[model samples]
Target: MPSPLTHDDPQAFGPYRPVARLGSGGMGTVYLARTAGGRTVALKTMHARIASDTAFRTRFRLETDAARVVGERYGAGVVDADPRAETPWFATEYVLGPPLDDAVELCGPLPEQSVRALGAALCGALGQLHASDVVHRDLKPSNVLLTAYGPKIIDFGIARAAGDDRLTRVGVAVGTPAFMSPEQASGQEHSAAGDVFALAGLLVFAATGRPPFGHGQAADLLYRVQYAEPDLTGVPSSLVPLLAQCLDKNPFRRPATDWLAAELHDGSGEFADHLPDAVLADIGRRAAEVWQIMPQRLLAPADEPDMAETVAPARWSRRRLLLTGGTATLAVAAAGTAGVWAWNERGGSGPDRPPAPGPSNRLLPRKRLDSIWQIQVDEDDLFEEVMQPGQLHVVGDMVVTVAPHLIGVTAKTGQRQWASNLMDSDWQVATDGERVLGLGPSDEGASSGKAGGDPLLVTSIDLLTGELNDPQVSLPEFNGELVGDQLVCTANGIAYVVAGRGKFVHSRFTANQTWYLFAVDLSTGKRLWTTPLPARRSGSVRLYFLSAAVVGRDLVALQEANDGTVHAVVRDTRSGAVRWDRPLAGVKASSVQLPLVTDARHLYLGAGELRALRLRDGRTAWESKSSRPGRTYGPPALKNGTLYAIEKGLGMVALDPGSGRVKWEEQGGQGVEADLKAVPVIGTDHAYSRRASKLWAIDLSSHAPTDSYRTTGNRFIAHEKSRTVISMGGNFLAAFPLR
Candidate 1:
C-alpha cells in the first residue's frame, strides 16, 4: 500500500510530482508520482549521499540510459529521468497491479498452469533484457507486478549493462537474498543467466507461496542459494524438471531465457485458468482504475525533450550549483529524512578535494625489531601437492604449518622441529591445539575415474612430535567420484567433516544429492556418529547440505531449503540430540565461506553487521551496528573479551564483546583496497594489518600505527608469543620481529 508523503518528502522532482510514498530500503525511497501530462509513474531517487558520489552518478546515468534503450515491452518502461540532478531521479511507467508477492498472499499459491504462464512471460521479458545487453540483477516476487495483460518486471535500480562493472560497492551482495543465483551468492560476476535463475525462483514462489529456497537470515538464505538445493515440495510435479534445470548451480547448465519461454509458452489460457476469478477481477479493476487516470496520449512540453532522447547530453554546470547553492541544497533536501544527506555532505570536502596525507613511513624505534629471518620454502614443489598456500598456526613455542604435509618449526630460532608427510594436495587441515587433522581425497582414488574407488582419507598428527599417529580412516561414502568435502575442527578434540555425495538415486526424487556430517575422534580417528542432513523436497536433480560447527560442547548445524528459510539446529555434542533448534535471526548469511568464529562463551557471526550469540542457550548476546550502512563486514577476530572486525567502508574496528561497544576504529583511507579476509592479527601489545603491499603494526595501547613495512605480498600471519610478523612473498616466507 502506498503511504502518505511526510512533510520532509519532496513535493516535486523535475517534471514529476510526488503523490505517495511507495517503498524504501538500503538503496533509496521510491515514490508514486505523476508527470504533468497525467501519466502516473514510479519515481525512484538515489539517496543524497549516493547521488553525490561521482562514480555512482556516472553509473546511474549509464544504466538509466541503457534501461530506456531496452524499451518498455518486458519491464516498466523508463518514461522520464534526470540522472544529473542533485539527487538522481528516474520515472518508470506505473505498474498498476499488486506485486506478485502481495497477490500470492491475498489469494494463496497460483496453480501450476498459471506458474508456467508466469514463467513464460517473465522469460520473454528477460529475453528482451538480455538481447539489449542488460541484466536485471534484482528480480524477485516484489519486483514482479501482476498486470492485466501479464506480469511486468520492475525495480531496475541495480541493473547493469552486460560486462559492466557492477554498481554494488565492495562487501555488498548485489541481488535479493531469496532469489539471487548461486554465482551471485558467491560474489561471482553475474550475467544474463543469473536473471534466468532468478526467474525460476520467482516461478517456484508463485506456485508454492514461498521462495524456491526457504527464507531466513540473509546469511543463511545466501548460503543455501550458493550451496544447498531448493525445496519444491508444494510445486507442481509437471514443472519440476524445468524448474530444476533452471535452478542448476552451474550457470552454464541453465537454459537461456528464450529457450525457457519456448518451453513454458503453452497457450494464453494456461495463465487465466490458474489464476483465481477473484484475483483476475481485482487485477482488472486495478488496471481500469489506472487507465482512468493515465493520459490517453502523453504530450511532451515544448521545451522538454522527448522520452526517446538520452538525458546524458544535458549536463548542468558544477560551478553553477556551487555559486547558486540552490541545486546542491535541493539535492540534499530530496535525500529524504534518513539523515543520509548529512553523511554525503560530509563525505569529503568536494568532488575534486585531495585526500588527507598519510602517516610517516619511518619505523618506530622499538626494542623487539632487531632481528629478522627469511625462509625460502619450495613453494613450487609444496604447491604442486597443495594448490593454495597452507594456513599457519601458532602453538606454544612451535609454529605448525600445514602445506599438504605437516611441519613444525621453533618460533624463536626458526628451526624445523619435525616434518610429517601424510597429506595430499587436496587435503584440508584443522587443529585442536595438540593435534592437526588432515582430510582429503586419497591419491589413488582421486586419480581414478571409477565410481567404486575409495576417495576420502583422514590422518592426524601430534603437534608436539610432528609424528603421524593415525589409524587412517578411509571414507568410501565420499569417494573421489563425489563432489567434495570440508573439515572443521574445534578446540575440544572433535573434528567434523562435511562430505558431499554428488548425485544419487532416491525413490521419490530422480537425481538427488546428499551431504553428511561425520564427527571423528582426533585421537582414535574413529567416526563417532554420522548424520545425514535433511534434504529439501526439490526434484531429483536438486542438491542440499548442512553447514556444521562445533561450539562449546554443542553441535550447531544450519541448513536452508528452497523456500529461503534457514534452520539452525544446536545439538548436544555427546548425544547428537537436539538442544535447541530455531531460525537464526540477523543479517542474511551471505558470507558462507567465512568460517563461523566462536570463543568459549559465544559464537560470533558477521555479515552486514556483527552479532554474538551465547553458546550455552543459543540466545543473542549482543548485536553491533555497522558503522557504514549496507557495508559488508569481514569475519571477526576475537581475543580477551574484545572483537575485531573489518568493515568494507569503515576499515578495522575494535569492540567490547560484552556490551558490543566500539572501543576503537581505524579507517583504511578512502580508496585503499584492504583484504577483507586478511583480518588484523593481534599481538601482545600490537596488532598487524595488511593492505595490499603494506603491513602496518598498530600499538594496542594507543590504537595507532607505530610502524609500517613494505611487504612483497598482502597475506600476513602474526605469532604474538614471539612478537613476530610472518608474511608470504611468492616462494618465500619472511618473519619480522616486532617490539
Candidate 2:
C-alpha cells in the first residue's frame, strides 16, 4: 500500500514508500505501509529534525524492536520495520476506528459489558507487552483505538524494552506523564504493574469521560498522578474493585494480566459477573491479610472517641458503620457474591395513594411506594449537577433546577416539565406559595433578551398551570425577599423593590462573576433597592458570595468572613436597614444552606458538618461531625425532633435532635461515600434510608417487626406535605402516605 519516495536525494534515499496515514503524536507520524512484495506492514517516521539525529535513530530502533518483540495479543500486531531507514520507520497492523476518546465522545462510554470487554482486551495486550519486557510508555484514551473487533493498544513510539539504554537517550522522558504510573513519574523505570496502572487510568477515562488528573500541563499532571487518588466516585459500582486493584501503588499488589483478562472476559456479559477470579481470590487473600495485620496495627484502638456518640448505636444505625465489619448476606441467589443488598422490612406507613391492592409481604425486592413509582430520569453521559444553594429547588409539585439552563421536572414523577433554550440567562426559580418566580438574565451588559443595566427579568407563573400569571416585570437592583406580596431585593449595595406584586426577586452576584441568587418580581417591573454584601471564601477558599434567605419579616444574609465565622445579618424587609448583625462563633463555613424545613425554631444547614442550629440564637442544637473515622460526606435529615444521619460503609443513625442523644442505628454496607447523593426520608409512621443502590424503609411507632421497602438503582428522598417519596434507582419514584 506504500508509494515509493522517488525524490532520489542522497539524504532521502531509495524507493522508500508512504502508506496510509496511521496517526500523529507529540513525537512523530505513523503509517500503515507495505514492501514491494505486497506484504502489509506499519511504518512510523520521526519528524524531520528528530530523524536527523543519530542518537534519535538508535532509540527509534530500540522502540521498533520492542514493538515487534511485544507481538500480537488483542492489540495491533507489530510487523517488520526499518528503524535504520533514512527517516527511521517501523510498521504495525493498521487498526480501524477512532481513538477511545473519539469513540466515547461520539457514542458515550461503552456500556458495562463493552467496558468489561475493552478492559479484558487491554489487559491481554498489556500481558503480552509485559511478557516481552516492554512498557507502553504512553497509555491514554487517545492512544487506545476501539476497533469494531475490540480495543487495540497502539502508538508505542515511546515504548521501552526492559533495561534498554535507549529509554534514557538525551532528554526524552518517554511517557505521557498524566497516564504514567506514580512509580514511573518518580524517575523510576516502568514496571509491569505500571502498565496496569496506566490501564487503570484508561478505565477511569472510559468511565468518567475525563482523566482522573483532569486537564493540566505535564508537570502538574505528573504531580497529581503521583500524589492524588483518581476521583473514581462516578465510576459504576461494579467496576470499582477492579479499578482499585489496577491502581494499587505498590507493584506487588496489582492484579496479574491473566487475572485481569479473565475478569474482563467473564464479566463482559453483565457488570455484576465481571469480577476477575483473581480479584475474588485477592479479596479473600487480602481479607486474611487484613485480619492478621489489622489486629496488630490496632484498627479500633481502645481509647478512640466513641463513634456511638455521632449517631445511634445498634438499631440499623450509622454509629457502628466505622467498624470494618465483613458480614455478608446470601439470601438472593441472583445478587451473586459481591454487591450490597437492601436491608428492608415490612408493615410501615400505608401507601400515599390507594395502597397498591396487592397481597402483602410478597418479598418484592423492588418496592413501589404507595401510588408512587420510581423513575431514573437521569440521561447517560450526564455530569453531576453542580448548582449551589438553590440548585435543587422545589415549588409545589414542580422542581426547578439551574445548572445553567432553567429545567423543570415534576416533583412527583421526575418527568421533565420543560428545559429552556435561553443561553447566558442562568435562571433560578423560587416560589411564593402560589406562583413560580424566575429571576435571571438581568445582569449588566446582558447578552440574553432579559435586560441590560437592570438585568433582572421577573416572570410569575401559576404553580399549578405552569402559565404566566404576571407578564415580564423589570426591577432595578434585582435582589431580595418576598413577604406575602412584597418583592424585596437588592442590587448595587442598596435594598429596594417593586412592591405588592405576585412575588419578590433578589439577585446576589458572587465574586466569580456569576449570579449566585436572583429573584424577580412576579407582577410588575418596579425598581427595587439592591444591597451588596461582602463576599466569602468557599470550601476551597475560592472567592464566592454569601447567601441570603427571607425568614418571616427578616431578610437574613449570611456570610463567612475571611476569618472562619458565619456572619448573619438580618435586614428588615420593609426597610433596607439591618435589624441585627451577629457572627455565629465556632462554625467554619464555606457555603451554608438552610433547607426549607417546616419549623422556624429548627434551622437545618450544611457545611463541613451537618448541624441543626436554633434560629432564635446562633446555638448549635445538634451536629453530625462526619470527621470521625468511617464517616465520610453526607448530610443529616431532620424531621420533627428526630435526625437521621448516615456514615460511609455504615448505615443510618437516628438521633434525638434536642438532646443530641443516640436513639437507633442500622448496619448497612459500604461507607457514606457510596450513598452521599441521597438523604433519608421520613414519613409520619416510617423512615426510609438509601444505601448504596438500594432503598429500605424502617417502621416507627411499632414494637413488632418493622416494615421495609426495597428498590433498585440509586434512591433519593423527596418530601411533600404529608407524603414522602423515594426516587428509586432506574426511573421509579414511589410515594408513601403518612397516616
Candidate 3:
C-alpha cells in the first residue's frame, strides 16, 4: 500500500494527479498517480536540491530521453516526461509488486528454478536495453520490481547511452558502490558489459539472499569489486559456471545478455512458477488492489485486441498492462496462483528438438581406395602410445603429420626423413610449400599445465629438412588466450599469424585483451611487422580466432569477438597494414568455425550462407543463400569454376563462382544420408566429400552420385594440387589417388 501524500508533495505534476507516495530514494520520490484517462502510473520527480544542480539537470534530461527511446518491453514504459520542469518529473506504467530485495527479505532465498527464471527474465530486459545502445548504470535489487507477471527493471535515472562519458568527466563514479562493476568503481567508460556484471550481482543476491561481494564502505566495496572473487558457495552446481563467468573480473570474459537469456529460458520452468506460495499470494493481492483502484474506463474490452495493437500502443490497455506488470498479475487473472506447485502446469516445449528422421534409402555400395603409399606407426613409438593424431598437411613433396611431435615424410617415397621435438597438442598448423608454421603451446609449456602455459609459442620448421627456424616468437599468457588455437597462413615466403593475448583479470567493463596479426619472414624467422586489431567491448565469453588464409598475397582472417561480432579482416602480408575490416553479412561470429578459402581473386566463406569477397578490397563479390539458410554448415570449396558445399537440410550445392547462380543441387534420397565431415574436394569430373567412415563421390555435370569409397578412419586431409588424399585411422596413414 502507498503512503498518504505528505504536505510537501504536490497535488499534480503536469497532467498526472498524485494519489499517494510510492517510494523515495537518493534521486527522487515516486508517487502513485492517475492520468486524465484515469490510468495508473508511477510519477518520479527529482529531489529539489538535486534538480537545482545544472549537471544533475542535464543528466536527468539524457536519462529521460534514453528511457523513452528504450521503450517499455524490458522495463517500465515511459509514458511522459518534462525534464525542463522546475522539479523535473517522468511517469512510467505503475508496477504493483515489491522490489526484489524486499521480496527476498520477506521470503528468503529463491529456489534454483525461480532463480533461473528470474535470470532469464532479467536477461531479456537487459538485452533489450543493451540492444538499444543503452546501459543501465544502476541495476541493483531495488531497481527491479518482482511483479506478478515477471520482473520489471525500473528507474533509468542513471542509465546512459553506451560509451557516453558525460557522467565520468570528473572521474566521479555514478552507480551505487555495492552493485557497481569494476569499471564503474574505477571511473572508466561504461558499456553493456558493465550492466552484465551488475546483473550477475543481482542474480547472486536472488539465489543466496546476499550480494556476492557483501557490503562495506563505498571505497572498500569498490576495492573488492576490482580485486576479489565473488562468493558463489550457495549457487547451484549447474548454474555455477555461468554465474562465475558473469562475475569474471574481466568484462570481456562475461557472456552477453542475449546469450544468457537463451541459456536461462531454454525450456525450464516459467519464472512465476518459481515464486513461493506466500510471496505469490502477497503479490497477487497487491495487483488486485491496484487493479480495483484503477479506473474501469481504462480497462481493456473483454475481447483482447489484436497483437499488433497491443504491441504498437505506447499506453497499454488494462489487460495488456496487467500482463506487462509482472507474473503475479498473470496468476491472479488466470486463477492459477498455485506457486511452486504450478511449475509443471507452465507448459513450454523443452529445448529445441532435432529434425525428425526422413524415410530410409538403400545404402550405397562401398568402394575401395587405390592407395599410392602407406606409413604405419610403430606401436612402441610415443606417437602411437601417447599422442592423439592431429592435422595432416601436404606442402610440395613433403607430407607433414602433427601429433605429440612434428614428423616430415617424403610424399613420393613415404619415407620419414626427420622429426622435431615440438609439441602439437592444442596447436594449429599451416603450410605454404616451402615452410610449415605451428601456433600453439611449446613442449616446455605443455608439461606445466593441462591446457598448456603461455607464452603461446610460435615455431617455424623447414618442410624439407624439418629444421626448427631461428627467432621463434612467444606471446604473453592470459585467460582463454589462443582460444581454439591461433590461425596461421603463409604466402609469398611470409607467414601470417592471428592470435589473441592480454589479461582480463582486473577490469569489468572494457576488454583487457588485444588481438594481433603478425607477419614473419618464413626463411629467417624474423618478424616483419605486427598490427593490433581493433578491440571490442568486453563480454562474458572469450573471443576465438575462427580461421585465417592468405589471399592474393594478402592475409584474410575471421575472428569472433566476445560479444558475438564476427570480423573478416584483410591485411597486406608485406607491410601488415590493414586493407579492410568488415563484419560478415548476416552472420554471428560464434556460428562459423571453418577456415576461409581463397582463389586468386576472391575469398570464399560459409556461415549460414555462402559469401565471396573480392581479394583486392574485401568487398562482397557475391553471396549465394543456402536453400535451408542456417542449415548450411562447413566451408565452401572451389573446384574449377564452381563452388561446392554441403547444405544442412540439402545435400550438395554447386554455384557459379562469378555470379553466385546455383549451377546444380542434390539432396540425399529419403533413406540415404550424405556423410559430411571434411569439406568437399574437387576431382577431375566429380566432387569428393567424406562422412565418418566413407567418402562420397558426386558427379560434377549431373550432380548425381558417382561412387562411395570406404575409408578405415573418419579424419582425412586432401591435397588438391597433388591430386591425392590421405586418411588417418589408429596408427595407419593411407594415401589414395583422386583420379
Candidate 4:
C-alpha cells in the first residue's frame, strides 16, 4: 500500500520514489522507480563517483542531446532526463526482450537468413540516426536488443557530437575491442562511417560464434584493429560482400547509411525469390525422414509419460557353454519366439493352460546396415567434449569413432559394441583387416623412455564374433606403418621397431640431417635400415602455405621466421626427410591455419596467390594472384576441379586450381570495413558463408542463397554440410537442416 523502497539504500528525489536497483554502468546506476504520477519508469542516475565532475556532466548532456536529436528524426523519444539534478538520471522507453548478447547466448548463433534480416533492420535504424547527424560511437552486440517487433540499438552514452572533446583519452579506450573500428582504435574522428565499421565487427560475431579477432586480451584485439584486417573467415556468405564494404579502412570510402540500408534491405534484386520449390521440398523431406526414424522424442519435463526416465529395456537371460576345454560360448535367443512356435503349431500346450515360463530372453531386432546413432556424451550438450568429428573407420560391421572417447559401434544400428577407457588427449586410431591400432603416448609419458611418447598399442578382435584375438603388439614411441606382413614403429624420426613374427629390425636417423627413410619389423623393438636426405621443421609439408597440399604420406607445415619469411615445408612420412621447401610470397601480419587438399599430382594452396606446384620437384605448376586487397585469411574451398577462395576484405573468387586462372568472380561488399572472413564451406552444388551472426547457404550453380537462415541473434561460429548445419555462440548449439 505504501510507496516501496527503490534501491537497498534509497536516495529519493523530489516527487520520485526509488524502488529496486536495476543495473550499473561506467557512468551511472539505473533504478526501477515510480514517479508521483504513479507511472513506472527506469530512472538512470549518475554514479556519485562522477556526479561532481563538470566534464562528466558535459558528456552526459551531450549524450542526452544526441538521443533527443535521433529520437526527433526517427519518432523514438528519450522520455525524461535532468542534467542539472544532484545525481543526474534519464529515462528512455523501456523495451522488453533480451540484449543481443543474451539472445545469442540463449539461442546460439543466428542462421544466415536471420543475420541478413537483422542487418537490414539495424541498417534502417542506422540510416535514421545518421540522417539526424547522430553518431553512435560504440556499437556492439551488448548494446543492441531484439524486441518483439524488431531490433533496437540502445545505450548512446558514449556517442558524441561531430567535434566534441568527449573522445576517449590516451589511457582509456572505450567499447569492446572486438567490435571497435580501426579508426576508433587509432583515435580518429567518430563519424557515421565508424558505426558502419563497428557494424562489420558485430556482423562477424553474428556469423562466426567468434569475434573477427579473437582469443587474445582486449589490448591485443585493439592492436589488431588498428594494424590488422579483421578475420572474417567464419562469417556467412550472404553478408560477406556487404560486410566487406562496411569494414573499409578509410572512412571516406564507406557507403552512406542510406545506401547501406537499401543494399541490405532490398538485396539489390540479386537474391529475389531465391527459395526454389525443389529446395523447399528437399528440406521438408529430410526433416520428415529424421522424424520417422526417431524411436521416441526427447520431450521436456512436462510430458505425461516421461519416456526419457520411465522407459526401461527388457532384460534377457544368457547361458555359456564350454567349447574346447575352457573356451566359452554365449548363446542368445528369443524365449517368446521358441514357446509361441511350440504352443500353436506343435500343439504341446494350450494358450490358456499357463505353461511353465521358460528363460527370460528376447533378441533385439536386427538394425539397418547404414544406421549411425551418436550419443552426446556431454550432459550440457556443449559439444566441447567433442572437439572435432573423428574419422569413421569401418571393418565389416564394426564402425570405430576416435573422438571425445574411443568407441566401436555396429554400423547397422549405431549400437556400441565396445568402448575403451583411455584418457588420451592427443591420439589417433588406425586399423588393419585383422587389428585396430591405437597410437598414443604410453603411461610413462613422453619424457619417459619406458612407455615411449608415441606408443603403438595394437589390439586384435574377431571381425564377425567380436572376440579378442591372440598376439597383441605393444611398442614404445612408434609411428607404425604397414609394410608387407609387419607393423613397423618409428621413434624420434630416427629409430624403427618392427612387430609380428617375433622378429626385430632396427634403423636410426641418418647423420646427414637431411632426408631419411627407415624399414623396421613389427613384433620386436628393432630397426631395419635408414636412408638419408634433409632436416625438416615440424610444420612444413608442401613448401607452400595456403597454396599447396601435402597428400598421401607427406605432412605440410607453415613456419614463420624472425625475418618475416614464411616457409612451407613438405616431409615424407615413410622416411623422416624433407620432400621440398619453398617460400610462400606474402607479407602476413598474422598466420591462419588451412587444411590441405590435393588431387595427387598437383599441390594446391589458397590465399592471395592461388598456386599449384609439382609434388615431386617443388616446381611451380601454375600461379595466379587474388583480386582482393589486404591480407588473405581464408583458404579456398575445392570441389571437383574448381577452387573457391572467399578473400578477406573481398568477395568470393572461383578459379581453376590446375591452371590458376579465373573462371568467375562474385562481387563482394567492400567500402571501408568490408571483407569476406567467413570461409565458404562448399558442397556438391552449394556453398555456405557464415559471416558475423548469420548463415548464408549459396547455390554454387547460381552463386546465390537458395534459402537462408537468419532473423536471430549474432552468430559466433558455424559448421555445415549440404543437408545439415550446426552453429554455436554465447550458450547453446543451434541445429539447422539445410536445403
Candidate 5:
C-alpha cells in the first residue's frame, strides 16, 4: 500500500515522476515513480548526507552490479542508475505482486506444491549469483516479491562478492537476525552454502506460518540461529530429510543449490501452476492497484519552516534486524549494547574458510544436477571385500562402467541395457573398439589360501545385449584366484593379460609366484604368444603396471618394478619380446594413474615437462623446453596431430606433435585453477578440463575457456559416436555434451 508523500519529498527526480511513497529509511527512500511512457518503476535513492560518503557510493555501485548478476528473470531488473549523482539513485522494474510476507499473511501457509516451486526458483536465482561468486548477505521474505511470472528477488543493497571483506567491519552483525545463517550471525564470512541454509529457512517459513526460529529479540534470535535446530514441525514428511541436510550445522555437509532444486521438483510445469488460487487472485489485484496511486503531498503549516516529523519509517533494510529489548541481550549478539554487535566477517574460531572448498576437500561435490545424464549405482559384489572398483570404457555406442560389477549403458541415452556380476575387478576388463572382453564371474577369483585353483575363464560380450558368447577360454596354467592378475589391453583381435601361477593372495605378492604376460585370440581362445615377467619381491603389495595401451604393433605399458620405480616398457605384438625399456624420470607410479597417451608415431608422457618418445626405438622424439625456470607441465593429452598439456602459470597449452613447437596457450585466468592430475578431454569445438572443481569448456576458436559446468568427474573420456563425454568418479558415472 502506498501512502501520501510528505512536504519534503521531491516532485520529480530526473525523468521519473514520484507518484506515491512506497517506504523510507535512514539510508534511502523507495518511491512509486513513472517514466514518460507511463511505465511504473521503483525509484530508490540515497540520502544527500549518505551520498556524500565515497565508501557508501562505492557500495551502491556494487549493489547495482549484484542486481545485474542475478539478471532480470530472477530479480527486479535494473532499468537505470546514476551512482555519480549528488543524490545517488537506482531505478528498477516495479514488481506487480506483494512481498512474500504480505502474500503469506493474506493467503495463509502455501500448499506443498507452491512451497516446492518457490524453493526451486529461489535456488535458481541464488545459483546465478553464486556462479559469479556473489552472496546475498541479506535474503529475507520482504526482499522477495511474488509475481505471476515467478518470484523475484530484490534488495541487493548489502550483497557483496564472496570472500570480499573490504566493506564489512568487525563486531557489527549485518543481516536480519531471524533469517541469518549461523555463520552470518557469528560475524563469519557467509558463503554460498550459507545462502542455501537461508533458502531452506525460507522454505520452512513458506510451508508453515512461522520462521524456522520463532521471532523474538534479535539477541535471542541470533542465539537460536547459531546453536538450535530448525523448528520443522510443519514441513511435509517427504521434504524433511532434504531440508534437514540443507540446514546442517556443518557448511560442508549442507546440500548445494542444484541438489536442492532437483530434490524439490523435476522442473515440470509453469511456476504459476503451483501457486494457490488465492495468491494468484492477489497477484492480479495488486497489478490493478499500482495504476490507481496518485501523488498527494502532506503540507506542513505554511509558516513553520517545514520541520520534519520523527515518525519511524517502515522496516526495509538493516533496521528490520534491530533487537528492541532490555540491556545486555543474549551472548555476544548483535543487539542493543555495543559489546554484543559484530561488525566483521571472520569464519571458524579464527580465520575464514575459502569461498569454495580447497582441492584437499574432496569430501563433497562442488555442484550437482548439471550433467546431461546420470545414474545411481548400487554396486554389490559377491566378493565385496576383495573386488576393486572398475574402470569406465567406451566401445562403439555403449559405455561400460564398474563399481565392482559391470554395467552396460547406451552411450547417447543413459539407459542401461544390461548389468551383471560377471566382471570382478578393475583390471578384468578390456576393449578393442568393436568388442568388449572381460573375465566371467568365477567364485574362484576370490582371495583364498587354497593351493590349487580353477582355470582362468575368458569371455566376450555383445555390445548391444551384454550377453556372453560361448566357447569361453579356460586356461589351466593361470590361477584365477590371484588378485594381482590384469587384462591389460586389447588390439586387433587379440587380448593381452598378465597372469600368475602361485598360491592366491589378495594384497600380497608371494616369493614363489611366477608371472607371465601373454596374448589370447578372442575368436578361438588360442594362445598367440607368451613371455615370462620379472619376479616380485617377497610380500610386496605394489602391482606391476600403472597403466597400459596398444599402439600399432607394440604393447606399451608403465611397469612398476620391485624397487617401486616406474619404467616405460614396450613389447613386440608378435612374440611378446621386450623391444625397449626406459625409466620414467621423477614421476611416481601412484601419480601417473591415467592410461598411456600414445599416437601412431610416439608415446607422450610427463608431469614436470612433456616429452614425446619415438615408438620405433623409445628414443626421444622431442621434449618441451621451458621458457621460464621452475615453470612445469602436467601430463599430456594427444588429439588430432596436436598435444594438450597444462603449463604452470600458463593455462592449457597446445603443441604441434611433429615439431613439438608451441601452437597456442589457452587465454583467460579461468584455467589457472585447472586440476593437473586428471587428463584433459578433447571435444569437437572445445577442449575440456577440470578447473575449479567444474568441467570447463575452452573455446577452440578463441583459445579461451568460455564456460564451466558442475561435475563430480575424476576422469573424462569423450564418446564421438554418441556425442557424449563420459565421466567417472568414486561410485558415480555421468555424461555431458561432447561439444
Candidate 6:
C-alpha cells in the first residue's frame, strides 16, 4: 500500500512528479511517480550523499543498462532515465501487479499449468539477459511480479556482466540468502547458469509456496545453498525432475533458458489463461486502482514547539492518512518488492560491499566424517584492500591466516597451535615454507592506525608457540607503523617487504609518504637491496601491491597504481630490480589477490585468455587450444607438471605446461559451469574445485568427480602430508579429504 509522502520527500524530481514513497534503503529511495501526461512510473533515486560517490553512480548506470537489457516483454519497460542527474535516477513503467510473494500469500500456490507458463516467460526473460552477457544475480519471489501478460523480474541492483568483476570486491557475497545460487552464496563467480538455478528456486516457491532452500538467517541460508539439497516434497511430480535439473549444483548441468522454456511450456495458451482466476482478478484490480491514486504531501514539523506538541496527539491526523476512504486501499505499483530492496550496500560499494560483522552468523567448529574438521577464524578487519578477505597460507603441517593478527592451525586436525595479536596489520606478518617472520615491537601502539617512526625490528615466530624470536634483524632506516607497508613475500632465505617512511597519519595512506621495496636475508639478518616505490594519492584505499609471491629467483607481483590500473611486474629477488612490467589488462587487481600463478619457467594467467609468459624475459607463450573455439577458460591452476583450468563448455581440462596441448579433459561431472574465479585445488589423486555449495573431488583415474563434500569455503589449498584440503571462507576454516 502507498505510504504518505514524508516532509523530506521531493515533490518533483527531474521530469516526473513523485506520487508517494514505494520503498527506501540505506543508499537510495524508490518512489511512485508520474509524468506531465499522468503516466505512472517507478522512479529510483540515490540519496544526495550517496549520489556524490563516483563508484555508486557507475553501478546505478549499469543497473539502468541491466533494466533496459531485460526489455519490455519480460520486465517493466524503461520509460525514462537520467542517472547523471544531481540525484541520479531512472524511471520504469509502474508495474500494476502484485509481487510474486504477495500473490502467493493471497491466493496460495499456483497449479502446474500456471507454474509452466510462468517458468517459460521467466526463461525467456533470463535468456534475453544471458544473450546480452548479463546475469540477474538476485532472482527471488519478492523480485518477481505476477501480471496478465507474464511474470516480470525486478530489482536489478545486483545484476552485472557475466564475468566482469572489476567493480566487485574479493569476498563479499550479495543477493538474497534464501534464493542465491551456490557459487554466489560462497562469494565466487555466478554466470548465466547461476540464473537458471535461482529461477528454479522461484518456480519451486510458486509451486510449493516456500523457497527450495527454506528460510533462515543469512549464514544458514548461505551454508544450505552450497551444501544442502532442495526440498521438493510439495512440488508437482511432472515438474519435479525438470526443476531438479535446473537446481543442479553444477551450473553446466542446468538446461539453457531456451531449452528450459521449451520444456516448461509449448507456447500454446495465453499466460493469463493459465494463471488462477483469483490472481487475474487481483491484477485487474491493481490496474484499475492505479488511476485512483492522488498526490498527498505531509507537512513538516511546526516551527513553534507549542504547535508541534498540540498537533502530535491527533489520531489518523497524526499519520496524516490523506487518501482515506476506498481510495486508500490502492497500493503503490512498486517496481520491486512493496518498497523493500536488499541492496546490501556498504556506503560506496553497492552490492560489492564487504560483509558486516554479525556474531550470530558465525560458523562454529564441527567434528564430522563429511568434513575433516572446521574451526572459526577472525573476520576481515586488517584493511579494506590489504587483508580484508584474510589470506590463507598452508606451509608444512600448518595453515596460517593473517587478518590483523596471526593464527596457526594444524592442517590435519584443524587444531589451533598458536594465536597472537602482536601482528596487528597484514604487513607485520610473513612466512616461508618452513619459518614465519614478523616486523614489530610487540606493543599495543605498534600497529595502531597512525604511521609512526618506530624502530623496525625483524623477528621470527616460533612454530611451537606464538612467541617472537627477537634480535633477528633491525632496519634502522624504516618504521613499523606505515599502514601502506607490506611484507610482500617470503621464499628460500629471503624476506621481501614494501615499506614507507612517513610521520603519524590520520589516514591509511598519508600524502607525504615515501615508499620503497626492499629485501633482507633472514639467516644473516642483513639488508640485501632497497628500491623506491611510486607515491600514492591522498585517501587512496588500494595499496601498492595487491598480491605478490616468489617464483624461484623471480619476484612476481600484481601492483595497483594510483590511476587504479594494475600491472603484472617481475622483479629480481636478489636485487629488487624490475626485470619486466606490463599492464594486466582485462584483470581486476582485487579479484586476483591470490598468490600469482607461476613456476620456474613461466607465469600463467587467465585474463581474457588462458596463456603464459616466460618468466626469464616475459615473452608470450603458446595459448591453450585444448577446448573448442570461443570457449573461455577459468583461472588456470598448475600442479605437478600439468595445468588444470575450467573450459566454458568442456569442464575441467588438463593441458601440457610447455605447449598448452590437451593432455586430458574431464569426462563427467555435475555441470560444465565450474567456478571461473577461484583456482581449483590440485591433489595427488583428485582435483578439487567448488560448484554451487559443494566441493567436488575429481578422481584422476576416471576424470570425474566421484565424491563431493558440502562447503562454504571461498579459498582452497591442499595439505599434502595430511591428505586433506584446507578451505577458508564464510568466516570459517575447514579441512576436507583430498582423495
List model 2 lDDT by residue over 1-739, tens digit each.
1222222211211122343444555567664443443333345667656876766766676565455444433455543343434455555654434567876676565566556667776776676566445678788988886543345576666777554544474333458877888877877777778888989888888877777678889988888877887778778898988898888778789988778777655533332243333323433342233212210111234566423111111111010111112121111111101101111112222112211122211112222443444322221111111112223455576665442334455756545454433311234455543445654433233233221222345666554444444566644333222111122333322223322211222211123322222232333453343444444232222112244556665565555565756676556665555666677654444334333332455555543355665656546676656324324435567777887766555656666766556687564333343355466667776666665444556566541124444555343545564255634334233444333
Candidate 4 regions exceeding 4 Å error are 1-8, 11-16, 36-38, 72-76, 166-172, 267-739
Clashing residue pairs in all predictions, respectively, total 25, 61, 17, 90, 11, 2
Candidate models: Cα lDDT each:
0.62, 0.49, 0.63, 0.48, 0.72, 0.72
The model with the greatest TM-score is 5
Model 3 per-residue lDDT tens digits across residues 1-739: 5776654466577657777777888878988887554556788888878977978877776666555544443456565565646688887767657788988998888888778777877876676566445689899999888754567787777887666565566467878888888888888876889988898899889889989899879888989998998989888888888988988888899998768867765634444566787677777666557544532112234585422111112212112222323332333222111112111113521112212221111111111344566554311121211112345677777778753346676665555665443333345577766667776654343233332234556677766556666666654432222342354666676766655554323222136556666776655756788877667565323233556777665777776655566778777777888788887656765444444677888888775678888878878887765333445545677877788877665667788877777887874451145444456767787777665466777777777776766676445666656677776664445666565
Please give the range of 10 consecutive residues that has the lowest summed lDDT in model 6: 310-319
Q: In terms of TM-score, which candidate is stronger, 4 or 5? A: 5
Error at 364, model 4, angstroms: 64
lDDT by residue (tens digit), candidate 6, 88-140:
77888777788999988989999999898888888878876765467899999
Off by over 4 Å in 2: 1-386, 411-417, 422-425, 442-454, 462-469, 476-521, 527-529, 535-549, 563-565, 580-598, 605-612, 619-634, 647-678, 702-715, 721-739
Model 1 lDDT per residue over 165-234, tens place: 5366544578799999988887777788898889889989999899988979999999999889899888
Superposed on all Cα atoms, model 6 deviates from the true structure by an RMSD in Å of 17.5
**Candidate 1, residue 90: CA error in Å?**
57
Tell me model 4's lDDT, rounded to 2 decimals: 0.48
